[model samples]
Target: MKPLKIAMMSMTHGHTRKYYQTLKDNPKLDWVAVSTANDEVKEIFLNSVDGIPCYNSELEMLDAHPEIEAVVLASENSEHLRQMKLCAERGIHILSMKIPTFDMDEYEEMIDIVDKNDLVCQVELEMHYNPVIVRMKELLANNEIGKIKSFNATNITLSPVWAFPWQGVPEKSYGKRVHVKEGDPRFRGGALCDHPHIFDMIRHMTGSDFDCIYAEVAPNIRPDIIEEDMLSVIGRMKDGTIFSLDPSWSKMEERLKVPGPGWEVFPKRMEVNITLNGEKGTVMADCFGPNVYHNGCPNDRYTVQYTYFDEWIGLIDEFVDNIRNKKQPLINLKWHKRTIEAMNAVYESIATGKVVKL
Candidate 1:
């Protein structure tokens, strides 16, 4: 099997660090060059001692490493279209970060570009690779819970503003500076924008699309932040299943320049748990839990040491297969478009204080 030559661009996303080790160690990928043009990101890559070359300009990197077949666009949401266009123009496959673009037209443009080039464009919604989620889907499919009547899910986490300030910037994170509410200082980008896993995951589990959605925002946990840190969404699926989701950055964190020890003020910095009530029984799951706990560290605070950080491994494995085998990824652009639409509906609901019909 030929290993896919992969590069990363724009190391400004929260998931940027999560892919470093996987990219380096994965057998199916040759983690080549990284281009950011950000001094801080370059310095961080230099300090990692991974020996992977870094370039200040993406064009320079591509010029030097013409063999690169794919790239992970680990940049802010606003840059997705531009970066994707560069990759598409080069006939390079792309592993896009979640929330490709809040603008539907731009999202459709991405689909067209990738389709025209016949390139494999996979969105990085890695939760589908989670072991727990895999089992959850199995149970749901097998009718272990009969029929899913309703579900409540949480894709909550601590804010990543200190580490990646782009998340707090409305224009960068949400691709616009539109206010979330008329009288509110908060903008469209925030916790809701940061967490799209639940919204995407529910669709896969139920094999249904959103029908209608109603969303509301609460006072942000951290008033200092410019975006909304807290919000909730209630909606109905096309299959008549009711759903409620909390995709908020409700957890608090210490302002850390780089995400590492002493960052999380809460015992659990991130969580993606779900409870589904079906006709026969109820199912509850923690997609990233049952981990080892420790307190003797840089912070001397209790923390969850995850047993598995292999979501990226599986994701990349599929990505490499898609490239090598000429197969479309399960979360291709067309399939993920509806997921993006559902998320946008949540924002529209908040702005209008009315239920949005998808």
Candidate 2:
């Protein structure tokens, strides 16, 4: 298959840095151009060694690189719809960030635009490509643990607000400035918006849609931020599997503009640990752990240096395969709509202080 000409827009997302190397190295993608949100982002991107052309406007980038067949919409949660519409207008395929938009109407509009343009729109739920999660899915499918009775998952991480401040803003992160509750000091966007993998992954594990969900928010760990940083969700799947999720920014990190060693004040900067109890037995897994430990010059603090990083490789591969072979991706917009609905239900449950039925 020919390498699909690709570009990236809005270098303001937390996942922007993670995709540079993979985009450049992937055989199926021809990393061509990038457009930044502003001069600050442009300067930062230009300083990088990738040497890709940077444009100040999406139109300019798209016009200059007319050969570009696809784009990675690496923008904030609010910017997804506009950027996606631009790509759709140009008849280009898209690989959007995880939280496309909190507004269901906009999400459906995006689906309509993509369908009208006949383009491949793949959401970046990269956990689907994680090897450990892959193994977990296999085990569950094999019924090695029998019918799943209950499971708990933690998608905890240190807040990236220092590097990506948009994450701290309610409108940009959650797509609106709705209050969490009447007297609550914080707004709707925070750790919950940043972490959606566990919510999306549970569906693949149980082969079920959300039945009902109950959620609660704890006080913020970083009190300076105006969004909720700690929260939990307990829900049941339609298939009778009950699950709990801790998708909080509980881990602490130094306010580093760029992530590197010494950024973590905690032993592990990020963790995704899952535990399951089934009728026959129980299983435990770490999606991004059990790696080599190091305490070196950067911070002199012990840290877990990650060993696996090919999730994006597989994700991009699937995107290209879907485009080239004319097959729908596993996590297409229609399939992901339910995950977004479930997440919205979490916020609704928090606001109403009652279980939300799906």
Residues 1-358, candidate 2: write the lDDT tens digits: 8999999999999888888888888888888999999887787788874678899999999999999999999999999999998998899999999998889999899999989999999999999899998899899889899988887999999999998999999999998898887799899999999998999888888888999999999989899999999999998999999999999999999999877778899878889999989999999999987789988968799887888877888898999999999888898899999999999999999999999999
Clashes in predicted model 2: 0
- Kindly give the stretch of ten consecutive residues in candidate 2 with the minimal lDDT sum: 42-51
Query: Residue 223 in candidate 2 has what lDDT?
Result: 95
The 10-residue segment with the lowest total lDDT in model 1: 42-51
Which pairs clash (backbone N, Cα, C closer than 3 Å) in model 1? none
The CA lDDT at 166 in model 1 is 92
- Cα lDDT of candidate 1 equals 0.91
